[model samples]
Target: MSTIELKNLVISKISEVNDEAFLLAINTILDSKSESILILSDDQKSSIKKSQKEYLEGNYFSNDSVNEEMEKWLKQ
Candidate 1:
């Protein structure tokens, strides 16, 4: 069926219902559609920007190098 038809069908079905808990659950599901944005702190923002700069400057370790270091540490 089309989107409008489906929505209308749901509305008709919901109107015939009288269960408080079920209606609350439906309301919660609808409310979750628009999620809130994350608010980052100054320190976190600075750290992310610093990491991005480091990445752009090619100062980061390779995955193979990190794995080798982890293996050495684990063996010790």
Candidate 2:
């Protein structure tokens, strides 16, 4: 389901819940989500842009291939 649908489902479920403690826990989680702001430095931003360019050029390794190589190296 989409984010909206998932959110509506959660809201519906929470409405059905009558436990005060459980509602408090959910409120705490929502509060923490609002506080999660991230600030990236210029160097980090440049690195991310470079990585995105490389990805768009199809220059990245496949997850399965990387795992296979890691397993082989670990066995050495």
> Model 1 clash pairs?
none
TM-score of each: 0.60, 0.52
**Alpha-carbon runs more than 4 Å astray in model 1:** 1-17
Q: What lDDT would each prediction earn against the true structure?
A: 0.95, 0.97
Summarize candidate 2's per-residue lDDT along 1-76 as a digit string, tens digits: 9999999999899999999999999999999998798789999999999999999999999999999999999999
Q: How close to the true structure is residue 67 of candidate 2, measured as C-alpha lDDT? A: 100
Model 1 lDDT on a 0 to 1 scale:
0.95
lDDT of 1 by residue, 1-76 (tens): 9999999999999999899999999989888865556679999999999999999999999999999999999999
TM-score of 2: 0.52
Per TM-score, the best of the predicted structures is 1
Clashing pairs in 2: none
Model 2 residue runs over 4 Å out of place are: 1-34
